[model samples]
Target: MPSPEPKLIAGNANRQLAQAIGRRMSMHRGMQIGLVDARVERFNDQEIFVEVYENVRGEDMFIVQSTSNPANDNLMELLIIADALRRSSAARITAVIPYFGYARQDRRTKARTPISSKLVANMMVSAGIERVLTMDLHAAQIQGFFDIPVDNLYASPVFALDILHNFKGAMDEVAIVSPDVGGVARARELAQRISAPLSIVDKRREKAGEVSEMTVIGEVTGKKVIIVDDICDTAGTLCKAAEVLMDAGATEVHAYITHGVLSGPACDRITKSKLKSLVITDSIQPTAEVKACENIRIVPIAPMLTQAILNIWNGTSVSSLFDTATLEPIYEPLYPGLAFE
Candidate 1:
């Protein structure tokens, strides 16, 4: 007996990446993928409408959507799509979120703040997402929020491979700096892989969209500092930390963040900052602003993700799919810089 073909479907969050994944799976004939627009629009009242164009009856479906900017809309799109698929009798629906939003709001900082990350996870499960496949979440513990089998793939291998390629000998003098104490585990893992020293950016994020006070916790003097974090939203934290690293005598500063959710003024800050190069993964499609920065480079995870997807479909262990590869980051044309007064 043969197995039924699994379906690959993508929402409007990131079609380019989805297409690349589909292209990789094209080798397997008889496998069909459905791409629905799944974009909701607002009328007068801030109401949302969702439509699923394709039929998913009794089919194994993967909904590819990255909850990036306009995070709420993209998240609703994914949930509604999952609901539609479930109601239509899809055998199993998997929400493949490359960039999960509301992740930073995982814990309650104050007495009454909501754990929105857990809310998002619960919503997906309620919407009929039987499983989840996502990349480096802002908080690793967010995996526990999911009741379904969640595969949290590491972008470290991808980032580590690229760092070794371009940075080359700099790895010997490298100081992997975690932008905050919370990210020490991830930073230390990368540092170990590259045989580099680990450092910490002991800082306090006083409030959202605000500058943080950064203190270099390790010896970064005269070393090439490589900052690692899961996401870079405003670039405020990273840019400020870069300055602190330089002041601490770091010869050069570079960053390898998994998701470049580079929102307002982030590109400008990166372009004018002290960092030599900023490496980001294509987990979320870089916004126009981010793409324009001269120092920003994108490393494709299509191949990495393709392998993971295939492994999932084949009932194989997804752990080894994150094996280190020898690939360099891809440098695309920079966006035109607008000078500030």
Candidate 2:
């Protein structure tokens, strides 16, 4: 006999991404357990309310929520949904947080600063979340903040495949660059995968969210440089790095980011910057303004997330999906109704 399908719930945050993951689950794993009938609403004073209309008693439950913009509201909505699931007698509750907010606050640099990421993790466990699934966390050590099982997935394989496909024959002319010294490891992985040279934008920060100066570390003259990073909020660092790379003699500069937190003036900066293109994942739903950016593109990770969900259900190794040989290069775009061009 076949096993029972795991039920999925979508919070208000990134509902489209959750629905896409559900469709891919049915298409790839043949599991029809799509988004559970849940409605999240607000009251006159802006208090949140959630109702689950499905019969999910004793079922393995998963809630797909990305604590993106308006982080507090989305985070609270997730906790409330989890509480509802526990009250409904869900056997297991896994939070599929495609983009885990507060992850960048894993540690404190100044005195009396709260480690918000740890606090968030504790709240989730307190609210009855048994497991966590997130992609390309800003800091990997944030996984240690949670007491339950945590799966931190990477978007490297898809990115590597896309790079290999686009730069088919001229791999030598391509260079992978980290927008900052912190991201060199991530950039090096892609550089090694494609056998391209690695570079770093060595930058000095005078304060939080401000860079004083930047200098290129490696040879990037006359090469197509691709900047890789986990987050792109405000696009200040990204745009500056592009200018520095161009000044250092890069033929062109492109960016491959995991979470596009294009909060304020981000799209405008990218639109006016020297970047040839900016490729980001659908972890955070694109706004109308983001879609209007000419050089922005979105890649869907529903298939990969679906496989990870299935593996988690079966108690298998989700890391095995990273095997490059079994995967094919994404020559064309995956998600529809986004700026793919």
Candidate 3:
């Protein structure tokens, strides 16, 4: 007998990404994977209201929501959705969060502070989510906070393919740069994939949201540099790092980040900075300001996400989808003519 179909539901957080995932799954599976109707609205006084229209009784459910800007509202929306599905008798609920906000607060640095990431994890479990599917968490340790199974996806494969395609014959002259010491591992992986050298930027953080100084630890002279990072909030670190790299005689500096949380003044800073371009995944929906920035390019990770959902539904391992050794070069754009603006 065939397996039962899984229900795909999305909130207001990232409808475009959710729809793209649904469409890709439908095409790949040779059957429609339409998103289940779910209304996520607000009361006049700012309370959240969620109503899952279709019956989810005993069905496997995936709720796609990225708690991006207005993080609290979106987070609450996801929690409510999970609770609703649990109450409706869904067999299992998977929270597909592309851009997990508050992930940077995974650890406490000061005298006394909360680990907000752990709190978020607990809330998901309490709301009755059985699993979590997310990408490029700010801190990997955040997974340990969750009791339920959490599948953390990577964008290295996607970025590697794009770098190979775009950089082509210039691969030898390309260097992968980690914006800070913390991202060295991620940068090394990409560098290994593309047969490029790795470099690190030693930075001192005087306070939150600020990088006081940066020192390059590798030779970037006359090389095309690609700064690799997980997130770019204000574009401060990236912008400063790009300036330092260029000042060190690098030909050009580009960035490939997983989540572009391009908050206050990010687009403007990127616009005026020396970075050649900033390529980011569609984890967080770009705002109007981000779309207007010519230096910014948004890549679609929907195909990858769709395959993950399909694998989970089929009781298969998710890691196989991104196994670099066996993965082929992605020749075609996942979403053709996807307008950034």
TM-score of each: 0.88, 0.94, 0.95
What is the C-alpha lDDT profile of model 1 across 16-98, one tens digit per residue? 89887786666544455435445545658866666666666777788888998789878988888888889878888888888
Error of 1 at 226 (Å): 0.7
Candidate 2 — which residues are off by over 4 angstroms? Answer: 1-3, 329-341
The TM-score, computed over Cα atoms with residue i paired to residue i, of candidate 3 is: 0.95
Report the lDDT tens digits of candidate 2 across residue range 1-341.
Answer: 22388778999889888888888778766657579988899999999999999888888888999999999999999999999999988899999999999998999978999999999999999999999999999999999999899999888877877677666677789999998888988888877777788989999989877899999999999999999999999999999999999999999999999999999999999999999999999999889999899999887887778778988988999887665443442223432222211
Q: Write down the lDDT of every candidate, Cα atoms only.
A: 0.80, 0.87, 0.88
Answer with 1 or 3, whichever has the higher TM-score.
3
TM-score ranking from best to worst?
Answer: 3, 2, 1
Q: Candidate 3 residues 173-254, lDDT tens each?
A: 9999998888999999888888898999999979876778889999999999999999998898889999999999899999
The 10-residue segment with the lowest total lDDT in model 1? 331-340
lDDT of 2 at 103: 92
Poorest lDDT segment (10 consecutive residues) of candidate 3: 332-341
